[model samples]
Target: MTKRDNASQSKQFSIYLRSTNEWIPVTKEQYKEHSKFYGSFRKKKQDHCKCTCPHQKWWFCNADCETCKYRTGGDTVSFDFMYFNAETAGITPLEFLESNVNDFTIDVDNKLISIEIIHYIQDVAPFILSVASMRLKGLTDTEIAKKLGMPRTTLLARVNKTADLIREKFPDYNV
Candidate 1:
């Protein structure tokens, strides 16, 4: 390949620099240098949670430490580390399902929906409840419309109507 072709190809292999908050193209040599720098920096920055857990030997807190009922709040760790550690631990499907339930209200962007409001929606407009449930499960408008056998526009209209109903009935909700 020509030099220009090689440069373009190298552009496809890019690495993100967290410190710089940028994704930069890397040639093989540059990639090796960056990898070495990152690896050494990571090694130098190695830290362990200072929690009182007996199994605090790990570099980072593990699932066992997190789940231990006796765990007192220790040194606050970065959110990224906690998220990755949780991913490594792996939650059961039952745990995932149970976590979604809230006793009273579902809060989204400061808007609250109480259990009574949910029951009101079920009694007055059952379809709205279904749409809301599907939306909560991370379904897009198009996907929900397809599943409900309705047009995209109709789905949008229903969503708006549901919002309007909530606002009208529970003005304090600010939906």
Candidate 2:
């Protein structure tokens, strides 16, 4: 079969094997059976965790609270604080991991400044915040433009505008 035909066939008949982390061709009946099993497993897992913290929901919880690294300690902050910081900063914890910021301080004082800046951007132009987040995810200008369905030049212009706004608003701090 041609490459396009193979691609179409795979899309039609493939089942992802979670254990092997790969997709394999399967009969329609087999795919249906697997989907039923997987759906139940997902629902069960979603309701497994019983933690009270808002950040400790089933999907995001590690399920080992006794030895969790985020537990209160000498230098570690609580998971709730970390979640709040990331939320206020307008990014996910995973996005913070992908960031270039060296000092990962979890205290409120340090995060407050960033949170203020993010809130300002969010208030002024929410689109810039989305574009900035995509940029933070290591997307190139071309890729960001394509994903946002805008021209490359328009994306560049928006980026420049955001920088200018930041510089104007927070002159003491470098952008």
Candidate 3:
């Protein structure tokens, strides 16, 4: 295949590793990983993509992907890049995205105070009282803890600490 064809084929698929919580765009070489398992179940005449999960089904296999015992237990919630920015600045993704990229002033002291996107994220996506809210929104303390590989209580404590800091920073915005 031409280099252009190869490159396009690579970006068409993605692999989500639950253990590391990383999603990598797949390539032809990596496609062999899926082929290893699928090859055993196929007839001699069938090619790689011709198989159910590889080409026909596109990553959905009742055994490995669907019927697998750990499917539900897996960390499949796609992490919002905005969430990370918000966490860093103590805010929400929507707030971060909506915030002014440049907070500048000429009339004041001429000093530039860079306002981090996290500040807006926190302001826009304030912490909710109900844990269920967090769970429903994919921000569960347990999930965060798992993502960070920490204890749930410890993660919750850290979240509370961040919330406290956000509250302290913005008195009017209660976290």
Candidate 4:
């Protein structure tokens, strides 16, 4: 698929929490961990009728117009694009994760562990210092993982943990 298609491969989670009556924007990772899922619902096959369909943008025919029934005096077709977990919907995944005392969060909580994670990023700073360094030099994540003799999964976890540390350290900085 194209770049746009690849971009859309990732899903966004927008939550309307019933208890708080608030809209919470969550990250993609959060969506994966704490929710039932659905989607990648690209519109396919149009109708052949002459009636105008709202899904024309998806290139459907007139017969496919039923799918866009709002134009046909029907109430708009409300699709559950993603899984609706009435139970989970009332609470956010991040809040759920935070409630559980997971290893990742606990590691992040300890000052020594936090410093170690921060150091990993900082230690790599010089390696990333040059303007062209990011573009030109050295190992990719996979390569670095191999060189450091760590599993790719471990490396990724470390990197993710480091990034979380940065965010926690400077919430208002918008890193």
Candidate 5:
């Protein structure tokens, strides 16, 4: 292929928007900015943009983004980037579904990875993250318990609880 043909082949195609029933004539990379711009101002279910809160006007002290409530999030509700990217790239919906990249494996035994799993675990069972990470670093339950200064039984209990949660969230997967 010529240099121009190669360049064109490497380019991303437009995506079809279900909401407006229009084709977004932009590559996936280009859509990043477009999605962010539109996602921020995108209307919510209540017909109000999430940025209704005046972020520029600080209400209280700001230590960093971690403690800052004014920090805006990316447009998750407005656009399905994965679906759009796959469609624009001329991939089938089923192919897209099978090729998920949002998961992380802790070990060969329990390949635990999913955005929902991570978010829920972080929000509700935060301690599990420490346990999982330590275990992944080749630490035994006893060593983890000693390092964390918790009882081995307690550590084991939390691990079991985390496993239960994973099973609950992903029934088909062998946690």
Candidate 6:
């Protein structure tokens, strides 16, 4: 694989949550807990592909491309991506873990908010809110869980649950 392929590998943990249909960043530790595929990331014959389908700058294809067999896409093709979720984080995961409970809302309409929506919400569980904030800052799940004095998987669950809440309450926010 080339540099771009390596970049894609780096983005594996970068998940697109079921709540928001956009790419969301997650900690490497969280990826390990929720998804168990990174350690097994070895080179394989079917690791890549080049399709001749109609697409623009990487918009969604009609489910007919075979560039890779990542989970984001179907078995018929090989393109994949990630998305993420949840409460508005005013402070940060590190801060929350350190006993800081500042809840700040990232404006729903802010253009940059879409990059990480969890940091821009209001009213949510403290743990989940902290997890989202830490994720926005690009910390791995393991790191957050460790600092917050919780198990890795537990943190993952909290983050996912928060994402579900966001999806249910603000479907129009495009978070």
Q: Considering every candidate listed, which one attains the maximal lDDT?
A: 2
* Candidate order, lDDT descending: 2, 1, 5, 6, 3, 4
TM for every model, in the order presented, reads 0.35, 0.37, 0.24, 0.25, 0.35, 0.30
| Candidate 3 Cα lDDT to native | 0.51
Say which candidate scores most in TM-score.
Answer: 2
RMSD of each: 21.5, 23.2, 25.5, 25.3, 24.2, 28.8
- The model with the greater TM-score, 1 or 6, is 1
Off by over 4 Å in 1: 1-113
Q: Which residue pairs clash within candidate 4?
A: 46-60, 46-61, 47-61, 47-62, 47-63, 47-64, 48-62, 48-63, 49-62, 49-63
Write the number of the candidate with greater lDDT, choosing between 1 and 3. Answer: 1
lDDT of each residue in 32-93, candidate 5, tens digit only: 76555544443241143223334333222222333444445534342334344634575555
lDDT of 6 by residue, 74-109 (tens): 234312322223553454445454453322333433
Cα lDDT tens digits, model 4, 69-170, are: 433433322333233486665455555665676866766667565565456556754332232243356657777667667787886776566567667865
Model 1, C-alpha of 63: deviation from truth (Å) = 46
lDDT of 6 at 31: 56
Cα lDDT tens digits for candidate 1, 1-175:
8999988665655566444557778787877776676444333333433344333422222233445443554455433342325454755545544566552235552344577687778877788878878989999989999999999999898778877887888886555
Native-to-model Cα distance after best TM-score fit, residue 87 in candidate 4, in Å? 56
Task: Give all candidates' CA lDDT scores.
Answer: 0.62, 0.65, 0.51, 0.50, 0.60, 0.54
- Write one digit per residue (lDDT tens) for candidate 3, span 2-85: 999878755665665545556667776776776566455443213322333335543434234344332342222333533445
Model 1 pairs in collision: none
